[model samples]
Target: MEAVRATEIMVAAGARELRDGQTVVVGLGLPQVACVLARRTHAPALSLLLEIGVTNMNPVDTPIGLADSRIFYRATCWSGFLDILGMNLHRGVVDVGFLGALEIDRFGNINTTLLKEDSGKLRYFNGSAGGNDVASLAGRVIVIMRHEKRKLPTAVAHLTSPGFPGGRSRKDLGLRGEGPQRIITDKAVLGFDRGTHQATLLSLHPGVELQDVIENTGFRMETPKTVPATPLPTPEELRLLREEIDPKNVYLG
Candidate 1:
């Protein structure tokens, strides 16, 4: 069930922006899965720019990270890691940015730096690397995370990457392409309102109730009068997801 939910979230996020012949910067975890799925199922012509400097990678299995050799094996072009960060990312040529986070706020701010409590007990995970650049330069940003009260909080302890930090408002922030365009979770797919920057429930998966989504969110949400149900993965999509992208069962059962 978790596998299905994770895949659902990945695909939902992928479907929001992936287009043929576009270049995308993909982070690790769900972002990797989503990129692979998009290349195989939806946008075969899409070019992937991996953080480790492989571009247009088409791999049969999901890689652990940019360092995975499979990415180099299928890449159309390869460069130094610093080249991808300093030249490609900073130049604002990436069409889409896919990222995974431990916590995300209603304002589209992400936190993958630390896990802490009210008492300041900190348990650190992987520290921020190129996430700041990915959030800053990509044309569009899509966040993929699990839907839970603790994970989707009203605020994060540390603002590792700013979401609309300097802009006068959310709309102004989006003008620079810094704020998140969409958020996909286990239970539902959500997006921030263009005008208000408040998280809004966009679609729910089959058998998932609106209340289920509401309960997991940490802030007040704008739910539509008629929320749509998420389309189930087709047999071909399922087969590809299970057999090609995640054959080792890391993301699926």
Candidate 2:
């Protein structure tokens, strides 16, 4: 247990959100690792689709990127982006849009592109390679990112992907994908309120304080009556993570 790391916990938390037979469109970073963890654990039938045209990915090692050969290795199907992003994604067959973010707001809006002059120093990101499309088309979305004040801003300076925006709902915008359902971070798991769409505090990780989540968030979130400790990763989950999934510390590192 002592060797278990925060990144492991984060991956485990994100993985648990996936059900046994859900279809997921995974992004490049921790999201992809979490998807793999899900398939190897409880969701053995989980369909992992990368927008880069790989389907049913069971990577022996965490891929460096969506285009990495390891992600395509032993995959069930190797189609082009049109079949994946254009067809499966656009057709609304994706069950989950597992994504990472540079910054996310209380409304779950994510910014993976440039912060721009609004955030001080102007910076350019790779833009939303498939982020906007995934968020717009998946049946539901889940975000995985580190817990930090800067990363969890009151509002993202640049909105690369849509969420439950401050004023309008995803439906009002005519977006097909259900907006963010859960945000998994190192410190806590935050869920969106059904009515308000605000990122509500749900559970804190073991040894993480309420104040830790609060202070790390850019905007204050409403505390529920009970914020339980996140269920620690099971022994088997930890074992698989360390020994099978990321033994070399690729993504877990």
Candidate 3:
């Protein structure tokens, strides 16, 4: 892991979370690379849903983005947003949802909208796009974000995706999914502590230290007595990622 780039490690960590035959809602960037990697390796039957309505795409080449026509090669169908998000997701047919965040709190609440500056200025972002739907309706959500103190605030200025907001229950919010099941970062794999509703260290990356994880986070995360290191990416896995998935070094670069 030390020899590899951080983004590569992040992609590997992301790819490992996907299980065989699970219908996953994924975006175009690193998540798509992860999906392609999963299909080439252990999870050959994993189905991918792109936000732009392409379903079950078997990409012949690494697509630059959802707008790239390469994803349409042997795609299952090209439905509209209503069918994918309004129906499949709202109906709870999707098993997992992948989301990226501008900021995430210790409770996992996400902010993909505007960032509030110290002067009370709002720096607007593309407000939610399909993130709200994906987070709200999927069976379970897995967030992909790089761990940094600025991005990992104690709380987001705005809550675009609910993740145990204020340490409450999802049932109370009436959200369909199980909220955030896992948070995958370059440094560690984290899961919420049931008692504290705070991010807890589930596993660390191969060369990342506990202090590194702690110092980078905006809030204090609970650490167990024994934390396992995330399994290093296999050589075959690396090959698939480099030669097959993202040969152009699009995201893995």
Candidate 4:
């Protein structure tokens, strides 16, 4: 018997957004797993750009990070970070960029640098190395994060990477790409409203109700007139995700 885990549902939601032939800039974490699932399932022709300067690699195992050599398993090209980031990404040629954050605001700003503690002290986290650059360049960014009230704050304590700064137009900020197109969470999927650019509930995961989403979110989300439930992972998707993509349960677990 095949069982679908809740985490797998989030992974599949990320994969469903990918197209057949698009260039994706992949960061570490579940974003990597989601990209791999996309390639192996529907978007076989997807070109993956690793921060380490590898592109279109068919990895056999789940890589620990961008520096993992598994990224070079059968790479189409091995270039330097300069060529990938400066030339390609800066030019906004990459179609989709996947990211994760510890704190996200209603405006989509992300804070991975620091968080406030109960004692009123600032606790530092791993700083954004290339995330800011990626958000600034990718044609569209999709953030994958665990859903929790605290993580989804009304405003991030510190902005490590700008999403739609203050929900302003991308043109207003002189950004090359549209910031944070969608946010995939364990409980629901949120997208930016076209006019307001505020986080809007797009769909809820299976068994997650409207109130459940409302309670978990830190800020008030714009509820759509008709919020659909995210499609559950099919047997095939679950099999591929579990057996082929992340057999070791690195990210899916």
Full-model lDDT, candidate 4 = 0.89
The predicted structure with the larger lDDT, 1 or 4, is 4
Candidate 3 Cα deviation (angstroms), residue 109: 1.0
Per-candidate TM equals 0.90, 0.96, 0.95, 0.96
Expressed as tens digits, the lDDT of each residue in 92-179 for candidate 4 is 7899989989999999998889999999999999888778888888999999999999999999999998888888988899887878
For candidate 2, the TM-score is: 0.96
Question: What is the C-alpha lDDT profile of model 1 across 121-166, one tens digit per residue?
Answer: 9988776777877887777789887788988888866667656543
Q: Write one digit per residue (lDDT tens) for candidate 3, span 1-253.
A: 3367677777788888889999999864777777778888899899888878888888778777778888888998998788888778877899999888899898888899999889989899978888888888888888877888889888988899888898887887787778787888888888987776788889999889999999998888889888899887888888777778777887877
**TM-score pick, better of 2 and 3:** 2
The 10-residue segment with the lowest total lDDT in model 4: 1-10
State in Å the error of residue 193, model 4.
0.4
Error of 2 at 188 (Å): 0.2
Candidate number with greatest lDDT: 4
Residue 126 in candidate 2 has what lDDT? 79
Q: Candidate 1's error at 5, in angstroms?
A: 4.7
lDDT at residue 233 of model 2 (Cα atoms): 85
Residue 105 of model 4, lDDT score? 93
Give model 3 RMSD, 1 decimal: 1.6
lDDT at 239, model 1 = 72
- Put the candidates in TM-score order, highest first: 4, 2, 3, 1
Candidate 2: where is the Cα deviation over 4 Å? 117-119
lDDT for every model? Answer: 0.75, 0.87, 0.84, 0.89
lDDT of 2 by residue, 4-45 (tens): 678988999999999988889989788888888888889999
